[model samples]
Target: MGAGLARFARNRMALFGAAILLGLLLLVLATPALFPGDPFRLVGPALQPPGGRFLLGTDTLGRDVAAQIAYGARTSLLIGVGATLGAILFGVIVGGLAGYYRGAVEIVLMRVTEFFQTIPAFVLAILIVAILSPSVTSEIIAIAAVSWPGIARLVRGEFAALGGREFILACTGLGASDARIIFRHMLPNCTAPIIAVGSLLIGTAILIEAGLAFLGLGDPNVMSWGLIISAGRAVLRSAWWICTFPGIAILLTVLAINLVGDGLNEALNPRLRER
Candidate 1:
């Protein structure tokens, strides 16, 4: 783990990404203190550009863009981390059961996983959000519902590969229970790749949530980056700052996440460690 940390720290782009994420984290933590009251409140002059009164500017309705972003950071991080964790949890359970048990279990679970994979993930997420109605909880569930198939496949493959190993065979021969062998032994070995993939999934989840919010499927009561963009799309040419900042927010956040994810992949994989 120390060696892996060293490798990760050496990656300049990853370090930059980490710095960006750290700033965002600080922003998220200080949101309440920095910008009190409802972020949706009309707090300034309409169509205000970046200036003294409004740091980032104001939207058509005179809401502070900076405040919206600070509040939206909470929404983005919540949906991204929440959805990714949910997917990973459910995927490991389903995939672990299928891969360890194999036979009928693998066949059934893999088929269902494939069904999800065949559909367009964005479409599926939209459908889910639509059905459940737009809210943070529904958005997380929607993203997780669309996102789990990949994790499921990854886990299934890892477990399947590990199953044929001598260590596994020895565990079985030594009268180790299936649950014990899987939970205590096999699962830990799969953690590296899982962490790598999960990092990337967070970025994807954030993008999807942003897309949903842009389509006006987000929770209506709260401020969000996507909602900010959506509100400004009409006056994009005249008030480019309104959408531009939030768009940049989404882009930078996603890029930073991807960079960190790539670094994690390199650090975690022995084959890529030297590179």
Candidate 2:
């Protein structure tokens, strides 16, 4: 673990990405204290450009763009983390069961996973959100529902490979129960790949949430980056700042997450680290 951490820290791009993500988290946490004004309330004239008064300027409804972004960060992080965690939970359970008990269970689980994989993820998420009535909870569920199959496949493969290993057989020989072997031994060994995949999944979840928000499927009460862009699209020609800032936020965030994910993959893979 220490070696992996050292290797990850040595990656310049990953370090840079981590710094950016940390900064965003700090900014999100400090928003209420630093910028106490309401993000949803009208603060100035409509469609104002970046100026001395409003750092990122005001939007179509005269709400501060910077405030909106600060608040939006909270929403994005919430949905991304929440959705990914949900997906991981679902994937791990399905994959672990299928991999450990590999017979009819594996066949059925893999087929079900493949069914989800056959559907376009974005379209599936949209359908789920629409059906669930478009709240933050629904968005999280929608994204998780669409995203879990990939994780399930990854975990299933890991478990299938690991299940036949000497260590697992030794545990079985020691009279360990299936649940104990799966959770206590196999799962811990599988953690590195899971972490790498989960990091990437977070970025995917964020992108899915943003896309949903842009399509007007976001929670009406939340100030999200996609919602900001959607609201600013009508006056984009005149008020480019309104949309541009939030778009940049999304781009930077996703890029940072990808970089970190890549770093994690390299660091966690002993073969890659050795190379």
Candidate 3:
């Protein structure tokens, strides 16, 4: 494990990406304590431009944009982590079962995954959310529901490739139960792509949440980067701070996740090995 980490450290871009991600995570976790004023507080004059006191300026609601940005981090982090975990958990179980068992189970699982994959992710998420409540939990369920298909395909491919490997075959020949072979022998070997995909999905999940919020389907009470942008869009010409700061936050957070995901993909892919 130490040796693997040492190799990972040699990838300067990966290390930098990890640092940026960590910083954002820390910022989100500490937002409540670090920022003083209430995000909804109307202490400042409405539509104020960036200046002293209210650093990022004030919205039409007379609330501090800076405070909203800080709180927004927490919202984005929650959605990203929640959706990613949901995708990973659902993907691993379904993919593992299909790959390990094969035959009818594989066909059914693959077909279901393909059916979901055929639809546009945003449209599907919106449709699902539209049917049920359009709250944070609904948003999470929608994203995760669509998100897992890709993860399932990735895991399925990996599992199929690894199932026929010597170690897995030996485990099977030893009369190991399907669960034991699938979980212990095959799954551990598939971690690289899974980790890479999970990292990449975190960014996708964040973007999806932002998109949902931008479309006015997200929780009205939540202070997400997307919600800030959506609220600011109406007054963008007069008060650029309303959109600008939130846009920057979304951009930076997404960029950080992408960088980390890219680094992980490069690090984990043997086909991309350096000369």
Candidate 4:
């Protein structure tokens, strides 16, 4: 872990990305104190430019844009982490089973995973969220539903490759239980790529969540960056601050995630480290 951290610190772009994510986490934690009032409340004249009483100006409803942005960080973090974990968890399980026990099991599981991969991810997320209630929970589940297929395939490939290795063969020769060989042995070996891929998935999940919110499928009860953008589409020409700030936030967050993912791949991948 210490060596990995040293390697990660050496990558300037990844360091910058890590800094961005750290700042975002701090913002999410400080949101309630920094903007205590309800973000949705009308605070002043609508379409106010960025400055004066409100740092980021006001939305059409006179809600403080800064407040919305701060609060929206919470939504993004929540949904991003939540959705990624759900997807990775299910994916590891399904993929583990398929790869660890090939033949009929692999065929069946891989076929199901391929079925999901054939669908356009965003369209599938939209359909799922539209069918279910449009809320934070729904958003997480929707994003996870679309995300798991890729994860499953990745894990399956990792397991298949590792299965032929001497350590796995030796473990099997000792009559180790399937559960032990998988969870205690195989899963640990495959975590480097899994972590790299999972980091990227969080960024993807956030983008999907934002897209859903932009289309008005977001929870009416909460204020997300996308919801703010949606509210500003009508007055986009005049009060650009409303959408602009949040758009930048989403863009920066996703970019940071991607950079961090690259860093993790480099630090965690032994082949990369050797090179």
User: Against the unseen true structure, what C-alpha lDDT does each candidate score?
Assistant: 0.94, 0.93, 0.85, 0.93
2 against 3, candidate with superior TM-score: 2
In the range 1-275, model 4's lDDT, one tens digit per residue, is 68988999999999999999999999989988998888888889988898788898988888899999999999998999999999999999999999989999999999999999999999999999999979999999999999998889989999999999999999999999999999899999989889999999999999999999999898989999999999999998888788899999999999999999999999998889998
Best first by lDDT, ranked = 1, 4, 2, 3
TM-score of each: 0.98, 0.98, 0.95, 0.98
RMSD value for candidate 1: 1.0
**Which consecutive 10 residues in model 1 have the weakest lDDT in total?**
266-275
Cα lDDT for residue 271, model 2? Answer: 66
Query: Which digits, one per residue and each the tens of the lDDT, describe model 2 over residues 1-275?
Result: 99899999999999988998999999999999977967899988988889889999998888999999999999999999999999999999999888889999999999999999999999999999999898999999999999898888888988999988998999899999988998899899889988998999999999999999999999988889999999999998999998899999999999999999999999998768777
Q: 60-123 in candidate 1: lDDT tens per residue?
A: 9999999999999999999999999999999999889888999998999999999999999999
Return the lDDT, model 1, position 269. Answer: 83
Residue pairs with clashing backbones, model 4? none
How many clashes does the backbone of model 1 have?
0
In angstroms, the error of model 4 at 20 is 0.6
- Candidate 4, position 172, lDDT: 98
Greater-lDDT candidate between 2 and 3:
2
TM-score of 4: 0.98
